[model samples]
Target: MKRLASVVALAVVVLFGTMAARALRIATPAATTGTAIAIPAIDTAAAALHLAAAVRFPTVSLASGGPIDTAAFLGLHQYLQAAFPRVHAALTREVVAGLSLVYTWKGSDSTLAPVVLMGHVDVVPIPEPNLRDWEHAPFSGDTAGGYVWGRGAIDDKSTVIAVLEAVEGLLRAGHTPKRTIYLTFGHDEEVGGRYGARVSSTSSWREGSSRHSSSTKGGSWGHA
Candidate 1:
């Protein structure tokens, strides 16, 4: 019986070892094709500063019955308008649910379906007890040692600011998409997106316009 158990264990190990080796053998793609467009140099200093400034807002989203910071959300809206003047000038802005924002950039061709870019600005709050665990103040928007520190720095604000920056830059360059573009910024995501994403979707449906696809805050692309 002892010899049989030893043989079974050895056989299991060899099978798993073979399986691991096979899994590790990933083949390179046969053919990859893409245009090599030169990426323009970004002003690192300005980019970092802007991200840091966005981090300063403590737009905490809480579950129903929990506290929500409306002031921070409003402040972020004001900051976005000031930062991306061209976006505000070109895109038609509307507030949904009193706090959520939607911006539509009209396209040259009405036949093409619009594209929606969705991002949330609200973040989960850092509990008072966990404050000591943070390297910097939760709302300080600290930029140090090649890092931006704050609550919404990575959760949702980064995507929100990035989309605005891209749109503003494109507008400045006089670049217009063939299809209409919609920018939707949700105010609540950390808890539940009921008042944010869900409302935006319902609003779009009511408008009788279909969106081809949506680029979500956390890098998800979905067909609508």
Candidate 2:
């Protein structure tokens, strides 16, 4: 009985191994066309500076649902306006729920549905005990050792800055989109998106845009 069981187990393992090998052989990657499009160069130094500056704002959101730091968010808004003047001039911007922002870049084709891109500006508060353990000040926006160190540097702030930079660059190049684009920046995402994302979404819906594709705070992409 032992010998028969061993033989059966060996046969099962061999069968699975053969199946896996066959699957691997048939799972070859598709060939690429090898066509390369020329992308415009971006000013990395300036972008880094902008990101660092944005990180300086202590727009901390608490789980306790405390009062917001209005000054910080307002300061960030002013800085963005100064940094991307072209974007401000080309797109129509609206403040939602007193803190969140929505910018609409109307396209040439009215028939095409709009696209939405989202990010959050708020970050979780750093505990006082853990503050001493940080290599750099959480709100200092330190650019040292080839890295931007701060609270909102990686989360949603980077996404906001990146999208704005791309749009600003495109606007400078005089490139217009065929489909309308919406840029939504939520303020209270860390606590909950109630006053920020939810309101902005409703605003977008009111505009009659049915097709929605978005990239949210933690690099989550979805279609609605």
TM-score of each: 0.78, 0.81
Backbone clash pairs for candidate 1 read none
Tens digit of lDDT per residue, candidate 2, span 39-68? 557899899999999999998876645777
lDDT of each: 0.79, 0.85
Q: Rate residue 16 of model 2 by lDDT.
A: 100
Report the lDDT tens digits of candidate 1 across residue range 1-224.
Answer: 99999999999999999999998897855874634533434566776688789889888888887777788889988988888898999988988886888898887887867778888888887788999998899889999989888888877777887788778777877777766888888887776777876655556523435665555557688767
What RMSD, rounded to one decimal, does every model reach? 5.8, 6.2
Candidate 1 has an lDDT of 0.79
